[model samples]
Target: MILASLLRPLRSFRCVLLFSILIRIGLIIYSEWHDSRSVVKYTDIDYRVFSDAAHFLLNPGPENENVAQGPLKSLLGWKISLGNPYTRETYRYTPLLALLVSPNDWSHPSFGKYLFALCDIVNGILIYKLLVNVILPSSSHNAASQPPNKTEKHASGPQHKRDELSRTEIEALATTFSAIHLLNPMVFSISTRGSSESVLSLFVLMTLYASLTKRWDAAAIMLGVSTHWKIYPVVYGVACVSALSGGSVGSTSWHLSLVNQKTIRFALLSAFTFGILNVVCFLIWGHPFLEETYLYHLHRLDHRHNFSPYFYFTYLTYPPLVKQPLDSESLSSWNQLMRSPLTSFVPQMTLALGAGLYYGHRIDDLPFAWFVQTVVFVNFNKVCTSQYFLWYLLLLPLILPRFHVSRRQAFTYVGVWIALQAFWLGEAYRLEFLGEDVFLSLWMRGLVYVLGNCWVLVELMKAYS
Candidate 1:
């Protein structure tokens, strides 16, 4: 009878594995189909910008006009003036990212797209591992806490616990989450488009996983590598520091114990190793590469339509803001108008530091720390894009395991996002009347932007209290 019972589960497992493989195959087919067409083109402003950087990297030029673009181009190889018909005069925004896009035969546009898709696949795998091995462990513990059934009781005790998850059961759960990550529309869209979000997310997940295992050195190195990719990852470092400190505000046992000599030593060592690695990378790559990746992003004043609260308010009061096209010269004026007193460059830094210190004091509870830091970072940023949504998406599952919300509520939240995504696509595509009606499109996009983040803030407040 026991053999029959086990055989039934094995059959179910094989069925699930077959189903998963089919779904993955379907997704790959869809991705390839989408890549073949230029059916949707949104000016390709960012793509053109990055492509120019790639060109400059492959061919270095005089510093007179090129110096202002930033130092990242040097990393691609000493710039040569390849006076090719394809070379257009434009500045590259992201040099390191551009390097990845550059290929020996600069003719193929799909090279970078394929590379990003691969990163996206890797990201899905990492997230699956994190969920199954780390986050789901807590969920399983909660499940085990419930009273066992009569059959379970008969076979209960430590032996039953061991049987609860065989190697196959564990692998199934991992595979399920991995499939979910890959199918997620957000992941699929970004991966095929050559955006930096997939790469940044992979690094963030690695850093989080390392922290969860209490491997300070590995976590710190991951954090540094993430920042090297994009500045936004730095906010996660604050989250990590806060997590290392333990719980919300208070003098708990975890907080009290953090002051020990051994803890302090590990913390300092991690920080030193992270700092040195970043510094060395910056020096080897040169200041221009570091500046393009880190500093140039700081000076970006491009207010070319985003879905943040600032965009919504500006559109509501001054509809002209949406109509005005962005230009290099007008950037300074736009920055001056949209800039907030509290979130000024200096004040924002202060707030980040303050939040870091407060969270660091209570480091034992990393999830809560990550939640708070994500809230602060998103709320304070000047512009919020659809891709930025992944930051919250990645962190939400981690936080969800620690807190309980009704299944209905979870579904409702996800449903709202799906509706918003529809609106976002309509706006991006400028579909029919929707595209012509600039105010309506802007409002729809802006609403999604605000509500999505508002939900996160509400969740964070609950976690804090």
Candidate 2:
């Protein structure tokens, strides 16, 4: 019995998941050691930022009375705290994240790293469920990219109807998805670097899973939690609402039906959940809650050493000029251009909204639709980071099985992504680390990044269409 159990196919998933998790843990330890020794290690400043936040969370100190006075006072206190070496950080993440990391007792960085690694494990399990329940079940054998086996064809008979996946096939697909997620290079890099994107990824996956299962109330709360953590998931909420209400696909135009009972309940539940969380945070942390978390992002603009396509445009127009940092005053012209209604923000928002509407039209395979919508959303985002790639990369395995692709297209896609990333990294290394900012090279790098995304978007449109 023991031997038979060990040889079982289902057990393969267990073995794979365990191995993947072990590898991630090893990577986290390796990264910590690497960062300690090397100035140009893989870890970003985010690790330090989060550490500072985590430290502040445990030791908010006697500063609370001052912080509670007003947003201005709170900002001033935070600014003052920054100058002090001992207790010098304000929390920018949601309280839930602070609470999640608080159990480590502000003891060591390992606690947070371990917590993130554990979240990756949970994400692996969630990916497995997403594939089994949503992706596998919804696919028709005829519609699958691969041709059906002889047994499958026989089962369907002369009428040639599609056959459901067998239990064995379903388990295999689930295990495959779980492995891809757990062993993903991007996921490993993010988790090892102690980035909170892992936590965000978990809530986002839960939101997708809950929505796909028709658990509207749960979906709403999860969406609320995710959005409160990082603002981008709010874009997903639009897709969530549309998926719940259902959409008309065949036509060119699409509309959201707010009158639908499901949509109404989802909206109210989500708003209440999100509002309550923020209100509780306000009562406890006061004005600083909004100031540090949400408002900070509104004012935040990173024109230097970023991968955004718009970065080079601002650089060319504003010209940070040879190691001299571009001040806020200098960027005012670029900012004005970006904020203009006819340019920048409006077009990106319109494209994202249109993509969401297009994806929502599907009633049977909403998960795949949701994945496509997320890809579109991230691709067009105002700011694109390597870490942000995790958002849709995690979802691709679930969606890829549904589409048929030729070798040429696949090669083109992978080549485009890698080539673009490689070029950007090479230039970024020179500009950031080597202190060589060849002004023209920066423009070329940004153009390559933009073109790479455009190439990717075109491929996605071809595949999904």
Winning model by TM-score: 2
Tens-digit lDDT track for model 2 on 1-465? 998775464346888788878888888788878888998886657666666655565554564422233333455543322111123354567756766665455466667778898888898889888777776666645444445455443232111234566777777867866777887877877787778788888998898888778787899999888888887777776666667656565533445353488878888888888888887676556656777778765544445656665665555444334343335465566655653324445655676656665676554455555666566566655566777778878787676655545556667788888888898788888887788966568657867787677778667666652
Which stretches of model 2 miss by more than 4 angstroms? 1-11, 31-44, 63-91, 106-108, 141-163, 250-258, 316-335, 339-343
Clash count for each candidate, listed in order shown: 13, 0
Give lDDT for model 2: 0.67
Candidate 2: residue 270 Cα off by (Å)? 0.9
lDDT of 1 by residue, 258-337 (tens): 45554465556656755665565454445654555455555444445665555544444342333345443544555435
The segments of candidate 1 whose C-alpha lies over 4 angstroms from its true place after superposition are 1-51, 61-94, 104-108, 142-171, 246-248, 252-291, 312-337, 340-368, 419-452, 456-465
For model 2, name the residue pairs that clash.
none
For every model shown, what is its TM-score relative to the native structure? 0.67, 0.81
Whole-model lDDT, candidate 1?
Answer: 0.55
